[model samples]
Target: MEQRLSYLKQHLQQNDIGMAFIQGKANLFYFTGFRCEPHERLVSLMVFPNAEPCLVCPNMEVSLAKEAGWQLDIIGYSDHENPWEKIQQFTSDISFQGTMLGIEGELLSFSRAEQLKNAFPLTEWTKLDNIFMDLRLIKNEKEISVLREAAKLADFGVEVGVHALQSGRTEMEILSMIEFELKRKGISEMSFGTLVLSGEQSANPHGKPSMKTIQKGEFILFDLGVVLEGYCSDITRTVGFGAISDEQQKIYNTVLKAQLDTLEMCKEGTILGELDRKARSIITDAGYGDFFPHRIGHGLGTEVHELPSLNENNSDVLKVGMCFTIEPGIYVPSVGGVRIEDDVLITTDGYECLTAYPKELQMIK
Candidate 1:
């Protein structure tokens, strides 16, 4: 955390920015080692170019922040108090007129921006989102370790879901079993909603689980991930319930081949856009181009989806220590859909596949 703060401070000094007000929960945790959801309340880290940084949060979370290893001044305000006034009082030494302030423009709401403008009138506002993205683009050894564990848990989730599969069962019934078993293993949160789409429902990429019953000779898709120790993992797998059609087998093979081919391109110095193009080309050649809608993958770490999106237009080059997903799918309207995904980390030689729940077609008899 200290290193991250120092890096941000250096950037502020270099850019001639006087102060930075960071409010996003993920950004806060990245710099201060403290995480909280202050819904409707103002919680931020006030950083200065030449002065010590201070944490501002609700009065109820002061001790928790301290326990999170934040060794700095904390200004805790009650629910009724005006936090803007407290901020004004705390930053009295700094001149607001003509001063440059950095903020996350994407995460900051319009009302919040107006309040900031009123609090520090005449200050110029700049975006700090790109800076944060650059800082978190590469994962260190410690982060990779946590990601590895998170991926293992995600693989376990798929294993449990596959075992719970049975004919005539509702999608929600199997979905509940997956979460209940995860809870029994002490996992309290999922990175996203657990998705259990079956048969024609799987044709929708972002379909939700429902009471729709699972039938034989159809596909059951499981897309899920678990949040472990502030990190996240995401994996997707589609399995056969019983005897599937020949066209279904061909679709599954095409998706698998595309995903594998894309994974092989996950090496240091490779262009980010090429990964998506490779996968898309393979699927298109197999006559399923229109069905593959989304990009190849997205970066994964503190958040399930982060920087360095893998699409056909991204010019960024892949580097070692970069982690992202490589997911390819074919969603047909009436037939069904098939998607195979994996969490991967770029290495000097090639890449490491973190989510190892088998990609081959799984037939549950």
Candidate 2:
């Protein structure tokens, strides 16, 4: 937390911003080590180049914030009290008036912006999104450790889904089994809604789980992840319930090849756009060009999706410590879809795949 705070202060000095008001929950947790959901209330971290930082939150959360390892000065207010007025008081004490102010422009609502403008009419406000995004882009050692554990749990999720498969089971029943097993193992929540799409429903890339029952000679897609220690993991796998057509086998092989080839291309100095195109070419050559849709993958970390997107147009280059997913899929309406995804970590020499559930097309009896 101290290292993160020092970085933020250095950035503020370099940018010549007098003060930064951080309100995003993720950003707050990143800098202060305190995470909270401040819904319908004003919670902020006030930082200055030379002065000490301060945390403002609901009066009821002052103790909770301290327990979370935030040692800075804390200001609390009740629901009836005007938070903007309290903000003005804090700013006045630090002489933060008529100078450059930095804020999360992307997160601040229009009403909140107006409130800030009305509070400090003479202050100049600048957007701090880029500054903070860059700060959290690379994962530190501690963060990487948490993410590794999260990936293990995500692999466990797929394992459970595959074992729960049966011809008479509905998509929802399988989904319930996955969640129930995770909960039994002490998992409180999933990184995202668990996805268990079967047969024709698998054709929709982001389809919701339905009551449709599994059948012989059909495909089932399992896409899920778990949140462990504030980090997240996501993975997808498609397996056949029983005997499948030769065309289905061909499609599955094509997607698997695309995913495997893309993972091989994931190394330091690799351009994200070219990596995406390499995978796309494999699926295209297999005569499923139109069926393969969506970007190659996306950044993964604290949020299921983050920075350094993996797509055909992204010019970002892969760097060590950067984590993202490599998911390649071929969706055909009225038939079925096949997708194989894996979480990958960019390493100094090469790359390491975090999610290790078998990608081989499995047939469940």
Candidate 3:
């Protein structure tokens, strides 16, 4: 955490930004090694170019912040107290001139930003959203290790869900079973909502799991991930229940081919657009061009969706140690949909797939 803070301090010094108010929960946790959801409270990490960083939280969370490894100054306040006043106390102690202040524009609400602006009326505000993105794009060794373990649990999630599948089982029923089994293994939370879509519902890319029953000869889709040790994993798999039709098999094969072909091209220096095009081309040639709606995939890490989105318009080149997802899908409105996704780690020569759940079209009896 200190190393990350040092890097940020260097950036601030280089940019001539005197102070940075990290209000985003993710950024706050990343820099301070502390995690908390300050729902309506004013929680922030105040960092200056030369002075030590200070954490500001509710009075109740002061001890929790210390337990998270923050050793610097901590300012706590009650619900009735104005947090900005306490924040000003630390700034005044540091003799903060507030010439140039940085903040996360994307994560900060307008009301909060207004309060901050009022606090530093003379300071110039710079948005550090891109700076944070660039910093987190490449994963360190420890992060990759945790992500690898998270992927295993994601794979396990699919395994449990697939085995729990049976004719007449409602989508919600199977979704509940998957989460219950994962909890039995000590998984306290899912990275995102567990998705269990079947038949026509699967055709909707972001469909919600409902009481719709799973029937034979239809596609059952599972897209889920688990939050393990502050890291996250995401994977998607679709399988047939009992027997499926010829057209259904064709759709599934096309999606699998697209996903596999695109994944093979995931190596260092590969352009993001090239990968998206490769997958889109394969699916387009198979005559389902319009059916593939969303982008190929997105970057996955502490948050499921992060920087360096894999799409046709993004020209960013893939680099080593970067972990992201390569998910390709083909969704037909009426008939059904098929999507095969995998979490990939960019290596020197090629890439390694973190999510190892099989993508073969399974026929559950």
Candidate 4:
């Protein structure tokens, strides 16, 4: 916690902001060890240049915050007190009186952002969106340990999901069974809703499990992950229902080859855009260029989707100690779709994969 605080202090000074008002609960909890409530009360934090941090939280949660390991000064208010007043009090002591304040621009609601500005009429506040995110790009030892555990648990759950696939079964039935098996394997719960799409349904990249039953010669996409120790793991694998045609096998293999190609190039300091291009080019060569959509992958961490996006547009270079997903897919509206994903981690030595689930096409009878 002290190290994290030190890093944030450095970031605050570098950005030339007097103080940063962190709004996103996920990043807030990481820095202050306090997770804010929803609309019931304003969960606020104030960070001044070269100063110890402080949190403005509901009085009811102050004790919980202390218990969970709050290292800096804490300020609390009762429900009866207007939430804005509490925020004002927090900012008044730490925030610079007539200078710009910083908040997370992406996560804060427009109304809430306006309310905050109104509260601090004397101060000039800005959204230091990238300032906060910049610190989390590289993982520390503790973070990597937790993510490794999340990967193991999530990988086990994917295997369970794969075995649950079969013909004459509804997508929802397989979903229920996989959910049950995941918990049975001691994966407390899925990080996100399990993706169990069959046949034409798989054509949707994020298709919802439906009453549609499985059949022969169609693609089955399974994208699932497990949440453990506050970290997340995400992997996607598509399999053939039964006897797939030559065309279907080709599509499946193309996606598989694309993922494999990207995996070899995910190293420290690798250009992120070039990695996405590697996968896009491979699929394009296979004559399924338009069908293969979305970025190659995204960075994975506490919030599941964090920094270092794997896309044609992202300039964030791949760095050692950063963890992200490599999920490349091909979507076909009627025939079906195929996607094979893996969770890869950049290490000091070389990159290593956390998701060890078999990548070959499985044919469930």
Of 2 and 3, the candidate ranking higher by TM-score: 3
For model 4, where is the 10-residue window of minimal lDDT?
32-41
1 versus 3: better lDDT goes to: 1
Superposition TM-score, candidate 2 onto the true structure:
0.96
Of the two candidates 3 and 4, the one with more favorable TM-score, higher being better, is 3
Query: What lDDT score goes with residue 105 in model 4?
Result: 81
Cα deviation in Å at residue 354, candidate 3?
Answer: 0.5
Clashes of each: 0, 0, 0, 4
lDDT of 2 by residue, 333-359 (tens): 877999999989988879989899999
Better of 1 and 2 by TM-score: 1
Tens digit of per-residue lDDT, candidate 1, span 268-335: 99999999999999999999999999999999988889988998999999999999999999999878
lDDT for model 2: 0.89
Which 10 consecutive residues of model 3 have the lowest summed lDDT?
24-33
Question: How many residue pairs of model 3 clash at the backbone?
Answer: 0
Q: Where is model 1 more than 4 Å wrong at Cα?
A: 94-97
Q: Per-candidate TM vs. native? A: 0.98, 0.96, 0.98, 0.92
- Which portions of model 2 show Cα errors greater than 4 Å? none
Candidate 3, 174-204: lDDT as tens digits: 9999999889988997889999999999999
